[model samples]
Target chain A: MTVPAEAARRRIVDLFLSSEERLLQRWTQLSGASPGELRDLYQALRTALSSEDGDFADVRGLLAELSRARVRQGHTPSDTARLVFSLKEALYEVAEADGGPEALRGFVWFSRLVDDLGLYTFESYTAAREKIIIDQTEQLLELSTPVVKLWEGIVAVPLVGTLDSARTQVVMEKLLQTLVDTGSEHAVIDITGVPAVDTQVAQHLLKTVVAARLMGAECVISGIRPQIAHTIVTLGIEFGDIVTKASLADALSYALSRSGVEITGAARTRVAVRAERA
Target chain B: MERVPILKLGDILIVSIQIDLDDQSVLALQEDLADMVVSSGARGVIIDITAVEIVDSFIGRMFSTIAAMTRMLDAETVVVGMRPAVAITLVELGLSLGGVRTALNLEKGVAMLEHVRGAAG
Candidate 1:
């Protein structure tokens, strides 16, 4: 609320009122923003400078919206900030043209206000960018862990990428929920897409299996690559009695057999006769 | 202290815990379940905890103790209808409820007991 001397305020307001159009035009050209966007900011800045308390709330609000829009448009933070700083240059030209020590002094106070506003715009831009990144990360977490129903009374979680505690928690919750929803007695955790299997990852897997067992569902871990098997043996990580298979296909057949599903091959000659008739 | 009721369905003894399990009720229920299993000669015991929202380490241990006790009495114990949150909490607490069978619901629990008894017979 530092009302830079009454005389300086009056001088700036008078200059703004007399040449508002010219100042806005110059600001648009320098900032490379549309005239429509510059017009709202110009009016708010003029009102703020002329007000008794010298409040810049309206100006800051406009800048925040501008920065958020610029962030969505993929503009850099500095680029959004430069739009506000360029106004100082536009106003300086008008103040210098008016001529006199008073106008020059008033320009200094105006430049300080614009500096604060420019920094405010930079902060807003970064805040908006951070919000976008957080939303995307949440979406990726949900996208990565999907509980798919492989067959009647059978569910599978195809885990991909590195297994972290947070991702494992999501997978565990989703798998358990699906088990209850479908009333499936068996779940197969397919880790074919998982890159590595460290002790921590093994611990998470064991915890998940234990949790599912507590809920009365059997879990079969599949897709153990040769190198992962060696690492697991070297690490002395015991999967205990929990069944594991080398591939997803092996796991599926195992689950089917355990569920009492007899998968007999269809007659090939009957299929060929049907195809020939078609 | 509220005593947990045990309903006998043929050879299987069903105990559905619908209230918050304090220490006193848990101990009383364990004693009662043991006595019922002996007197009734139930072949299977199913403890349904679908309504239980919270469980401490003590309550978690009760499950293991009950399973062991029932087994000693010539009965198989199946903890059924355990809420997902309770299951996760028990796992986090490192109480795997080992040696105790579990099923998704009451119908499944009965089916599992039948399957076990049939296999054993």
Candidate 2:
């Protein structure tokens, strides 16, 4: 590199090594980070600056770890970046006290390095946050699709939320698997919790029904709210001979009757008569 | 070349496919099934595929082809015991096997055939 820049780098490394403890103390006080967190980062920074190639790999590694910890602690991205940037202020205080033209030049070089490290921390923080979001989304997908047995020969999938291609795929796979496991001939897909039903969603529903039929089970879609029925009719989407019921109760009874279950009201009336006599 | 065995249970013919179906085997099974239906005068046919794992377009069409052949011979064909993955693959491949009937298992398949017979009578 240029001769003056090389001299400036060396002068900064010397400053870091001379008063490492005091610089770390100032960093902790300025950044409001725990002393233990700042100490490891300070040592890594010193080692990186003193190295022949000035490779800041160790400093970056330490910053990434710090970023991950701050992310877990729910700290903001700026807060994590400021922790790295504050080290520059601590170093500047030392450089100013050890004043020389070379120290001033060295402070400029160090400031640029810290700026790069600060941005690196920000990048690491964002990456960690993205991982958390992806993990939560996967969990939510699993949680939302549940296949429950409604009767001896029937099962129901109570679907909630907006139906997307990915979520529909999960629901389809899970429903089909449950059908095979339960050997239930009837499945009622209850979409009461679904907010909307566009053509794409209707298509997914049709595919699921077709898949289940291929597995030798009949699917009855329930929870067709008034608005969704209007939308479906407006879109000219024909549910084609597949049964659509207005409520889960209707869907369940439809499934039961299809399976040859005769639900008589005699038992309910008997209980009602006993209550009246008492 | 492995041959899929076709068993006669009363008036119903049962073909349980337990082997991976290559083109040759599939074609052989189709020919053998058609012959058995005609010779035995079976009223119904149940093709059980619970033990089968994969089905491509050829094997899928083989199902429809067999169903149509049996129907022409005055026998009803009901495919039964299809695995979920296989069913989903068939659907995604756009081979719904529309003309053929399906039941969840062997018992259900037999029950469905009886129900159809009872209704027809």
Candidate 3:
């Protein structure tokens, strides 16, 4: 290890092990990122710092460009998490080929962030966004779903977009996290937006709602929008007593009204909308 | 773009805009409307924006400018037929087209202008 780089690594290790309050406080300001997430960021910064070549001044410019791209795209909390995860993974892949002690040490922090902090993958980011659509549909005060509390209560989130095994797992985790955050009782997951649901998507959603119910939250599944729903039913994939609503709105209202929130005005609009569809 | 129309309902000049109502389009519309108000000698101006689905924050900030132009030209202005969804979206998107007199429909918009003039007299 080079003198200064090794010293820097030793300092980071000490700060991590000693629970340095000042170091923690300073990192808290930069991104307010989770501790493990911050560790990932630090590792990413280390990679950018180490592999950076050419003019001594060029490193700042490269980072500036990356930051601009992030800002332009409206990077959210989840976006930051996925970015750190990718950077960590990429650094480790490169480190395996190069096999330098300093680079490997940097890889260690990034890998630890993923392992210890429960950070998700890039594909998981897409899955979360797709799931957020379910959140959006639930927030709608549509006819089938009556009360305003549907947005605040336990509701089903159908998976849409790509749910590779990696992201499917993250979606399951976030669903449980959101159930806890919202304190909703029932969550139904419909897999309509998912390009297709294999055994994995079905299994992931089932596991997620079960986890929620274990936490005293009820779960529902709706938005099994037509084709996807038909496919699952045809496959004889019994969803194990998981309530299925035709749509998210239907599921949300059923969940809320059962919880004693009367959804009067919303029901009429929902019917009227359906009648108009006919 | 040239997609927006500068229509005339008798002495009332109606400036109708469409598509995303951002700063560039608003500036172009305001400039054109000002010229139309001057050359056409309009006594009233009706700005219809029912077609706009996405309005940028900067577009909302141009309202007072258009309002001031109408006043200087001695032509009263009324905005007509902004859908509730569009309004809510605009507000949520943090665009406030404040001080622009709005009505439910074109008829109500015309009525508003007449009402304002009658009150003035």
Candidate 4:
């Protein structure tokens, strides 16, 4: 270490260790660390400063731990960075009191070191937050793609939101698995929950239908509102031989009819109407 | 040599494949099924594969071939009770068993075959 840096480091540590109450007060005012945590943080900071060139593994390791800790504690980037910058205030007080010609250069080097540490903490905080967001998105995709058994020979998947490739894969897998497990020949893909049907969404639906056919199951796509039907026609997207319905009820009825199961409810209604006429 | 049994139920030919069908067995079953359809004058063919866990490209092709041959002989083929994993694997393998009808279970498969026969007559 340089002569001035070593001297400045020792003086900074003394100021930090001697006036522990004042440092703790400043830390508490800036963030949410308890007295016990402030003690460990200050102790680690002291050890980090004594290390050569501030590029030591100990310093890097401590900054990473602190960054993650700050994120978990719901601390903002500025709040976490402020934790490191606060130490500089303490160092500056001691540096000014020293009143030596080299004190200025030493304080400047110390300030630069603190700035680097503060930025590192901020970087780690953002990275942790991004990972959290990605995990939540995966969970949401799983929740949205649900396979439901509609009848003895029919199962249905009601898809909602955007149908990205990853979500489509999940939907296809779940739908196909239910088809096999239930031994259902017909699968109704109810896209009523789906807000819009773009070309890409149509393509995903087509791929899923083809995959179901490969499993020896017939796929019926349902929930085509007027707008979606128009969009599909305007885009000139052909669903080929796949059966599509305007509603889940229509698809279910089609599936039931294909399976040759008669809905007695309709027959009863007709019989009741005939009885009333008689 | 392993063999998958082909049983006759009324005018319907029921082939319940309880074992994992190898290439030889699959071929034998196909030949036996085609012969049975012609000799018995069956109206419908139901191949129940409820125990089947895998359907590779070869088995997939065999299914389509059987359906086509039976249809040629004036009999409808319905494959039933395919497990989800097998379906997924078949789909991923890019095998869409066209011209082959499927039902969820033995009862449904039989019902589907009978329905087609009923519709035709």
**Candidate whose lDDT is highest:** 2
Q: Please, what are the lDDT tens digits per residue for candidate 4 over residues A1-278? A: 88767776566555656666776776665555566766776667666655566444666677778788878878888887887787777656655776664665666776887798788888888988888899998898878878888877788988887677778777877887777676777999998877777787777678778767755678898987788888888999887898988899899888887766655556437522111111
How far in Å is the alpha carbon of A3 misplaced in model 2? 4.4
Candidate 3 scores a C-alpha RMSD against the true structure in Å of 21.5
By TM-score: ranked, best first: 2, 1, 4, 3
| DockQ of every candidate | 0.71, 0.77, 0.01, 0.37
Per-model chain A TM:
0.84, 0.88, 0.41, 0.81
Itemize residue pairs with steric clashes in candidate 2: none
TM-score comparison, 3 vs 4, better candidate: 4
Question: Quick one: RMSD of model 1?
Answer: 5.1
Pick by DockQ: 2 or 3, better one: 2
Score candidate 3 by DockQ: 0.01
- The CAPRI class of candidate 2 is medium
Better of 1 and 2 by DockQ: 2
Clash numbers, per candidate: 0, 0, 15, 1
After superposing candidate 2, which stretches have Cα over 4 Å from the reference?
A2-4, A50-58, A107-109, A160-165, A265-278, B1-20, B36-43, B51-54, B118-121
Task: Give lDDT: candidate 1, residue A184.
Answer: 90
Worst 10 residues of 2 chain A by lDDT: A269-278
lDDT of 4 at A65: 80
Model 4 residue A252 lDDT? 88
lDDT of 1 by residue, B1-121 (tens): 8999999999999999999888999999999999999999899999998888987888888989999999999899998888777888888887877788899988889888888888999
Interface RMSD of 2: 0.8
Record all residue pairs in model 1 with backbone atoms less than 3 Å apart, i.e. clashing: none
Whole-model Cα lDDT per candidate?
A: 0.87, 0.88, 0.58, 0.77
